[model samples]
Target: MREFVVQQNQSHSVLITGSTSGIGLAIAHCFARAGHHVMLHGLADNETADALRAAFAGYPGNQGFSSADIASEAGCAQLVADTREAIGNPSILINNAGIQHTAAAHEFPSDKWHQILSINLSASFFLCRELLPAMRAARWGRIINVASVHGLVASENKSAYCAAKHGLVGLTKVLALENADHNITANAICPGWVETPLIQPQIEHIAREQQIDLETARAELVGAKQPMARATSPDAIGELALYLCGDFAGTITGAALPVDGGWSAQ
Candidate 1:
């Protein structure tokens, strides 16, 4: 596990959802390295949470803890209350908790779709809604939503994932407009493919199902699409999120930035 570290004399405090692993973890580390007071949120993983806290035990502005599922109203309320007590209200927010399943559109499980939408889309909205008042009063905030290439373009058997992300794009735009005067910026990061745990099993499943090498399985999805012909790095997205929250990005908002290595263009 990568340990999150905090740079000295940092002024920013950020809350990154689902930080126990993958892109979320990278984002937490990136902000921490910049010396931001980092709130690392994972979903109900006490063991992982303990390890993460141990990593930041001596750090200046780092802490690790679990947050409830923001997908539900009750969970969202609890998260806000606990965060308010633990850390100061966040100046930056990253909504990155999400899940996916591959099923034909008609056969897609309604329960699964509900779960995905509730977490991926609704959770973001609620977190923002809950946090916005404090952010507005402060007159400065950044909201970065972790969308996917599917948010901009559809592929086979990921209807719910795609729809939730698409809805996020719209939400980002509206929130940006609503908060424009308050120095609040909203944006979405749409990645093509990143070698995260969420996609690791998908790779194995496809490799076994299609009788192909792992590289071949990866290529089949990214084939001729991304000019780089590779998966993205969570660190890279983390860096971009850092940029968006910095002074230079003060004017950027509601933009869907694709870190897809040209997948969307193709």
Candidate 2:
């Protein structure tokens, strides 16, 4: 890890999508702190993401913004264009923008289903489609998709989320194979539960739906899992992405690396 940290070059441009908060923000800070140029993007307010960008202006490398919602084609195009303009074509792309909607499979609203797929699945694909040309021309890149333990196994609720993450794994594999000739690698990180804003709403809804104390509900959800029995931290993800983009992981691609604390190991 120290060698990896020391190897960080300030010149590398890393584009981290959906980086306004949660795992995305953590990754952004990780790369920045590690001395890489970072371009952060998300379905964020123009002013807010820009404010965050401004805060990083004093950092050693370039910091930038992409305010467009990544779920739409136009938004994705804008993101690619803005990212290219800000830094160069990203040598590292952490496809971390995602959303989750929980409901019984039968009661899942149609709009929610579409929304989840658009943001979590389709957007990731489009971002890759738009950026791959540059990466291929460079002959090296890392595409790290933030997937979930749900991609490996099922939960009672979160049908649409599972579908999208499961698809992400498949997508990662295909992208890896397709870009192998260019030395561009694609991989998925299947995290169990993380204490991100994305999960808070589900926690609140679960607490209300089950009529349990929030703390108790949280424990119940976590206790059901194995090993460390707690959610992974966002910084942990940041560190992982940092490593995946490093030269040490040059040979690792198309692998669904589970950063889940042994949850999917069961």
Worst lDDT run of 10 residues, candidate 1, spans 1-10
Indicate the TM-score of model 2. Answer: 0.88
Which lDDT tens digits does candidate 1 get at residues 1-266? Answer: 01111211247778888888899989988887777778878675677778888876665785647567777988887777767667777878899888888799999999999999999999899999999998899777889999988889888899999999999988999999999998889999999888776767767888999999998888776655677778888999999999998766878998999999798887
Residues 75-171 of candidate 2: C-alpha lDDT, one tens digit per residue:
8889888988988778788888888777999899999999999988999899899888888887777899999888888888899999999999999
What lDDT does the true structure give each of the candidates?
Answer: 0.84, 0.84
Error of 2 at 207 (Å): 8.5
